[model samples]
Target: MWRELAAIGRETSTGGYRRYAWTAADTDCRSWFRDQAGARGLSHETDRNGNQWAWLGDPAAGDAVVTGSHLDSVPDGGAFDGPLGVVSAFAALDELRSRGAEFTRPLGIVNFGDEEGARFGLACVGSRLTSGQLTREKAYALTDADGITLPGAMEAAGHDPGAIGPDPGRLARIGAFVELHVEQGRALDLSGDRVGIASAIWPHGRWRFDFRGEANHAGTTRLADRRDPMPAYAETVLAARRAAELAGAVATFGKIAVEPNGVNAIPSLVRAWLDSRAADRATLDTVVAEIERAARDRARSDGVDLSVVRESFTPVVEFGHALRDELNRLLGGRVPVLATGAGHDAGILSAAVPTAMLFVRNPTGVSHSPAEFAAEDDCAAGVLALADVLEGLACR
Candidate 1:
């Protein structure tokens, strides 16, 4: 399964995946998913919001046990971040079939679209749309860097733009949803465990900071006479690091753009996106507030106009205790429970469904990069663990 998916959307220069939403790369991934479902002889369908589902039994049968994750990737993302869960899902089903598990309920595997939000800047778009956390109007308003709207991209990719909206009936049929993923951090590695359960997702958000100033020739403009926004933007980046450290949170200026992006020209506008997260809502709020305040102070001193817009925000998500406890029992109660700073489709769906997650150990504790990895043994363990959970949840 990994071999088949490894080549799709991979950038030769970076050895990282670029499976962004509604692009050719993503289309290839969707095709791969369909092929996988067909190979397994599962009834397959694409939901209104573009999420794919493969069912082993009638989906109309309520209380279906569903497991899987997205197949999309961030810019130059690691192979395991999203695909691990999906591959593990199929592998788990094979394991269950080998064990001759008698199903008492329907089983499903899903590939939720646009979980990375690399192009549209909104994570978990498919799941969010299905859960009604994102309105069709707002989703239609989402535009990519190339000035293409989300609906336009969907249409170009041969998906219907008008069919997207909340699908409560589909969600209501799901009794439980479990997503297995590669550990984004070293929690399982540090604990000497191959698999762990997710406790909660930290409150996280993305904010856009724009600093406006006069553009001029970099070589000719005097340092004292020129009003450059780059310096202010740089200071804000440092300020964010300091604030996050002080508040025991995490913040990063991961993406940015500059008007007149040239080595010989001073930027007229420096726009950067801040991704911030904390264990709790109060700490997250405080960290972001301090960072914004520092940016404002620096912008005033640098004579640059500053504006901040919160592009997206997700509150902390605590997995339901009943489902989590059931998974613990299914896994022999030895797996460690850990919290994460990362957001996910499971986190988005937890609002409307009983959702949980499993994390495979990552030795390097790296993610969203080519260097991110998991051992073969750890992946095998993850697949077996998922198989056990599914057997307990859906089998007699």
Candidate 2:
């Protein structure tokens, strides 16, 4: 399975990956999924939001048991983050079939679109829309780095943006959702476990900062006469770092671009994206407010106009405890309960369904980069854990 993922990774040269939703790479990945599902004799369908679901039984069955994850990756992202769950889901299904475990309730495997928000600036787009967590109009208005509106992208991808909305009819069919993902942090490594169950996801949000200033020739323009926004941008980056440290949260200025980005030109504008997260809503709010204040102050001192726009916000999510207990029981206490700071489709689905997650240990305790890893043994362990959970949920 890792070989298949690695093969896909070899096709991209961008630092991690650039498989934004609806992009060529993403489309290719979707095709790969379709072929895989078809080979397994699973019936597949694409929902209005572009999410793909493959079923092992009757699709009309209400409250079907579902599992799977996204295929998109962050730029130059590691091979495991989203695809691991998906590959493991397939592996588990194969294992179940090999064991001849007859399942009465319907079983589904899904691949949610734009879960990384790498293209449209909104994570979990498909799941959020399907679960009524986000409105379609707002989703349509979202734009990519190149200013392509989400609606246009959707249409180009052969999905009607007008058709995107809460998919109650589709959602009603899912009784529970269980996602198996690679641990994005050091929790499992610190705890000495190969597999763990997720207890919650930290509150998180993304914000975009636009700083406007005068664009001028870098070589001819005197530094004092330039109203370049770069200074303010730099200050904002430092301020975000300081603010996050003070608030005991995480704030990152990972994406930035300068208009007229020429070595011989002073940028007219600077755009930066911030991803912030914390244990609770209050801390998240405080961190965001402080970052905004710092940006405003920096902009004023630097004489650059500024504006902030919220891209997405997801509050801390607590998974169903009853489900967690059941999973633990099924796993025989071998798998530990863990909390994640990363965002997930499961977090959005939790609003409308009983959602849970199982995380496989990353020996390196790192994620979102090419360095991320999960041992083969741990991968198989995760599959076993997922199968156990699915069996219990399906039986119940």
Candidate 3:
């Protein structure tokens, strides 16, 4: 499964994949999913919000157990972040079929679109929209880096933008959701285990900062004569790190856009994105407030205009206790409990339906980059673990 998807989107020289949402490559993946479902004789359908689902039995039947994850990637993201859960679902089905496991309930493998929010700047957009967490109008108004409206992109991609909205009918059919993913850090590795159970996802959010100043020729503008917002923006970036460190939060200024984008011109507008996560709501708020205060002070001193807008915010989520405990029991209580700094579509679905996550050990203890990795044995272990859970949930 890794090799199958690795061959799709562009691969960086660093060995990472760049499968942005709603692009040709993502479309290719959706097609690939149809092929996979066709080969398995599982009927598939695309939801109003672009999520794809392949069902083993009648979807109108009683609530079904759902598994799988997104196929999209962050720019040059690691191989396993979103794809692991998806591939493991396929593998688990293969495992179940080979063993002739009896099934009394319907099962589903779902592929959610844009889980990373790498393009739309809204994480879990598909799940959020499907569950009514975000309004259709608000989703349509979202803009990409190139200023393409999300609705326009949907239309260009052969989808009805007007059809994008909450899907309570679909949500109601899901009995539970299980997402298997590569651990973003070393929690499982430290325990000498192949898998871990996610206890919760820390409260997280994305904020955009727009700083405006006078644009001037870099060579002609003197430091004392110019009011450049770049310095203030840079200072705010550094301040985010300092504040996160002090508050024990995770903050990153990973995306930015500078107007004129040239070495010989002073940027009149600087837009930067801040991704932050913390243990609780208060800590997260305090850290973001500190970062904003720093940016405001810097902008004041530099005589520049600064504005901050929160693109999205997800509250800290604890996986449904019953399902989590069941997974722990199924794994023989060897799985470690860990809270993730990263967000997942499972976190979003947790609010609407019971959701849980299984994390395979990553040796590099890194993610969102080329350095992320998992041992083959660990991946196989994750597949086996998922199959065990599926047997209990979907099999007679």
Candidate 4:
């Protein structure tokens, strides 16, 4: 599965992947999924929100114990973030099936679509839509960087846009969900373990700050007369860092756009996004409010117009307690339980169904970049652990 997926997507010059959802690369990945499932005689179907599911037994026989993850990638994202969970899921199922393990209940794997939202700017779009967290209208109206609507993209890709919406009936088939993912940080590395269990996800969100100023030529504009928004944008970045540091949180101004981007022009507008996470809702709200206030103050001082809009917010998610306890006892590793600042489809699905996650140790503790890595031994161990968990859940 690894080799097959690696061959379809664009590996950037920097060594990361560019497998945006609904694109040709993602289409090829889906085809690969269908072929793999077909070869195993597993029934495969796509949900209303584009999530793909492959069932080992009858899907309608009973609520299935589902395991899997997203196949899409952030632009230039690490190879393992989404695909590792998916590949591990397939491997675990293969192990169980080969061993003559019988699952009385349905056992299934899923490949959720648009989890990264690299093109549409809405992370976990597939999961969110499936769980009714995002409305169909909002999802269909989402636009890419080039102003292409999501519906337009779906139509062009041969999918009916009208079919996109919340799917309670489809979601009802998931009795439980377990996702085995590559750890995005050094939690497991610090503990010297091959795998860990996720306890919760920190409250996190994305906010856009737009700053506007007068446009003038670099050669003609005097420093005293110019009201460039760049300085305010810089101040906003600094404010984010300060807020996060002071509040014991995390914030990043990762995406930015400067309008009239001519090297010689002191331009009109600066749009920057703040990705922030905190341990609690109150703390996160406070940190964001402070950052916004700071940005506003700096904008006023620079005579720049500023507006802040929240694009999305995922509140703190606690994994289903019973599921976590069962896995802890069933796997019997005394695996470390961790809280992640990063979001996942598992986290999104936790809203509707019981969801748990197993994270394979990432040696580099870096993600969303090319440097993120997990040793083969650790990956193999993760597959074994996931197989154990899935077998227990599906057979019990």
- In terms of lDDT, which candidate is strongest? 1
Position 34, candidate 4: lDDT: 88
Q: Tens-digit lDDT track for model 2 on 53-83?
A: 9999986878799999999988778888899
Which residue pairs collide, candidate 4? none
- After superposition, the stretches of candidate 1 with alpha carbons farther than 4 Å from their true spots are none
Which TM-score value belongs to model 3? 0.98
Judged by whole-model lDDT over C-alpha atoms, candidate 1 comes out at: 0.95
Candidates, ranked, TM-score: 1, 4, 3, 2
How well does candidate 1 match the true structure in TM-score terms? 0.99
Give Cα-based local distance difference scores for all models: 0.95, 0.87, 0.90, 0.90
lDDT of 4 by residue, 1-396 (tens): 788788778685768788898899889989988887898889998877788899898878767899999888987888899889888989998998887888988988899999998999999998998899999879877999989998888778778778787888877888899999999999899899999999999989999999999999999888989899999999889988999999999999999899899999997999998899999999999999999999999999989999998999999999989999888988995988998999999999998888999999998799998787999999999999999998888876
Tens digits of per-residue lDDT for model 3, 1-396: 667777788585768878888899889989988888888999999988989999999979957999999999998888889888998998999999999998888999999999998888898889999999989989988898799998888788888778888898888898989999999988788888898899999999999999999899999988987879999999999999999999999899998899888899998999999999999999999999999999999999988999999989999999988999999988787778899988999999899999999999998798988777888899999999999999988885
Candidate that beats the other on TM-score, 1 or 2, i.e. the better one: 1
lDDT, candidate 3, equals 0.90
- The Cα error of candidate 4 at residue 217, in Å, is 0.5
Error of 3 at 237 (Å): 1.1
As a whole number from 0 to 100, the lDDT of residue 284 in candidate 4 is 97
Q: Identify the runs in model 2 with alpha carbons over 4 angstroms from their true place.
A: 9-15
Error of 1 at 314 (Å): 0.5
- Which RMSD does model 2 reach against the true structure? 1.7
